[model samples]
Target: MSDTARTIGVVGAGSIGATVCADLVLHGFRVVLVDRDPAALERARRVVAEAVRFGPMLRPGLPRVGAAEALAGVTTYTALEALGGCEFVVENVSEEWETKRAVYRELDRVLPAGVGIGVNTSSIGIGRLAAETGRPELVVGIHFMNPAYLKEAVEVMRGAETSEACMAYVMGLLADLGKEGIVVGDFPGFVSNRISHLFFNEAARLVEEEGVEPAVIDQIFKRCFGHRMGPLETADLIGLDTVLLTLDSLHESYRDDRFKASAHLRALVADGRLGRKTGAGFHAYGLPAGGTGAAQG
Candidate 1:
């Protein structure tokens, strides 16, 4: 792929979005990353440059993108109108209804007809988000995992009004990235977050109520269940603030007490200790493998 390859618009310059931009750049797609925050965009540029230079060490299958090539593949902007010429756009803004709602409204006007929109959200429903756009059928969910370049599988959610054409376009995009899309139904939290948040919330509650250390809770699941990262550790990686918003979305959507976020988790978000991104939340990106690092447990 060349620098003149198809252009994809990525809204938001957060952790996930910046990583996604790198993945797109690595695959030879010209990416236009949009955010109102110029600082965030600069940070994204640095992150992309670093990932392209060093990310292949962890995943040798990826082509080594040079600084000039990687830089050529991305352009940053502070306006939504910059996305007008993009072939496709992925929205990775904060997990807030009002913020996303406003973005979708502007996207409806900015995007040319026939272009598709991928909603890379955690808990929000594709159908509900598509409702904000004039082309509901063009919206689909693309649940990209952390460190997206390393993830080979992605959960693709189909909105009720999503057209087959839209789904195919998204599938094609994922294929270009050397990723497989596992199609799923449209719903808040969908498959991953719906159940994952429950375990995360419960893990926090156990720490608050039973006084079990966070590390202790994580160890049980890792050693006993044979899972990689424990609930709390995963939550920390995902950002505690994001976890709270996702839990709140789940609770409100289901109207079930089980989905309510734990008070302990809520407090973490309120305090601004949001995981690895902040160098704090969840003991600062959790404990090391086979761990023993007194990380705020």
Candidate 2:
């Protein structure tokens, strides 16, 4: 498809979804951003505006695109039916099986036949997601990092039945967005989340079981281990609820005790402390509006 003719549909208008939409718009691709919540849709609009206005300052080599022109390319909708015109769909709904299953089913019915659906999940298996869509070969995982515009690499997972043609198309799409697809085999959590969540879960255990301070743990990792962000801080950035959900999915998929969710994490989630999005998770973000910050989960 020609660049001017490509319209991408992004399901869900949370942090990841909004970031992806903004990135697409900046790259001059028409985008359809969908969400059920009016508040989230509004937030997504604001996020896109902010990204267009300030993103270039943060990322040195971004295209010199006008904010108004970029914003004009995006259309926000409350219904999935609005996505019927899109050539490709990127699903970023919550990580729960039932929620994802419902979205995939609707996407399968609403989107035109032959259009690929990218499952942007953290822990759920790509094979399971493909099965839910009834188009195993067309459904592939494209795990774009948080703040998708700034990230240069995406973890692409090929489902058991995913075709080589599907993989090539997705990799080409990523290249168009100025991202490299680090393709890997389909697995629960795949590579990044599988290893990263282990570190996060252990850090939570340390804080809960051993009474280690969150800051201290993060400091040790950053200063001693030469890491950029500590696991707890990273969890905060990812949202505690999302972290818990991914952990639950990992435990279920692996049937392992070590992947179990931590008590401290559960307590924080139960109390509405959901990390950076919630204004408080392992630490506080100064009480943002909408419970659990801006995260969809």
Candidate 3:
């Protein structure tokens, strides 16, 4: 399909989903963003607007479109059926098996035959996700990083039955979004989360067990290791709840203790401190402004 004809459907209007929708629309692709929560949809609308106005500063090569023109290509809906006309679908629901399974089942029934479904999961296996859908050969993993628009690379994984045609289409779509797809084999957690989660979990443990401050751990990684963001900071940005969920999935799949969720992380999530979204996690933020919160680390 041609770029102008591509109307992408994005499920779940959370940070990642909203960011992806913004990036797609910024690049001149019509997008249908789906979410069950009205509040989330509203937040996504604001995110897209702000990204359209200010994102060019960070990504200078992006198409220079006004907020109105960028938003003109976006359609937000709470119904899954609205995605029927989309040429491709990208699912970014919570990282849970049942949630993803249900979304894929609905997409299988609604989306036309041969349309590819990209599962943007952090830890779940693409093979299992594909198994839950009727069109297994069209389901692939397109794991975009947090803040999808700013990131220039994405991890793509193919299920056992994913067809070559589907892979080609997904790769071409990523190119259109100005991203490099690092293809990897189907595995629980894939490459990025498998290794990154290890670092995040270990950092959480240090805080809980050794009484190390969150800032200290992050500072060590940033200053000593020459890393852009520390594990704790990265976990906060990714949402502590998501980090815990990923750890649980990794531990279950690998049967290893290294992937165990940290006690501190669990406590924070139980307290409703879901990082930047909730205004608190490892760090604190001020009240949410314009439906978005600033990360204060």
TM-scores, each model vs. reference: 0.93, 0.93, 0.95
Off by over 4 Å in 1: 1-3, 285-297
- The C-alpha RMSD in Å for every predicted model, in order, reads 4.1, 3.0, 2.3
**lDDT at 262 for candidate 1?**
88
Worst 10 residues of 1 by lDDT: 288-297
- Those runs of model 2 whose alpha carbons end farther than 4 Å from true positions after fitting are 1-5, 287-297
Clashes of each: 1, 3, 0
lDDT of 1 by residue, 119-186 (tens): 99999989998999889999999999877776788999999999999989999999998899999999
lDDT of 2 by residue, 34-83 (tens): 99998888777777777776667777676667767777788889899999
Better of 1 and 2 by lDDT: 1
Which stretch of 10 consecutive residues in model 2 shows the poorest summed lDDT?
Answer: 288-297
Q: For model 2, what is the C-alpha lDDT against the true structure?
A: 0.85
Alpha-carbon local distance difference test for all models: 0.85, 0.85, 0.86
Distance (Å) between predicted and true CA of 276, model 2? 1.3
Ranking by TM-score: 3, 2, 1
Local error of candidate 2 at residue 24 (angstroms):
1.2
Query: lDDT of model 1 at residue 162?
Result: 95
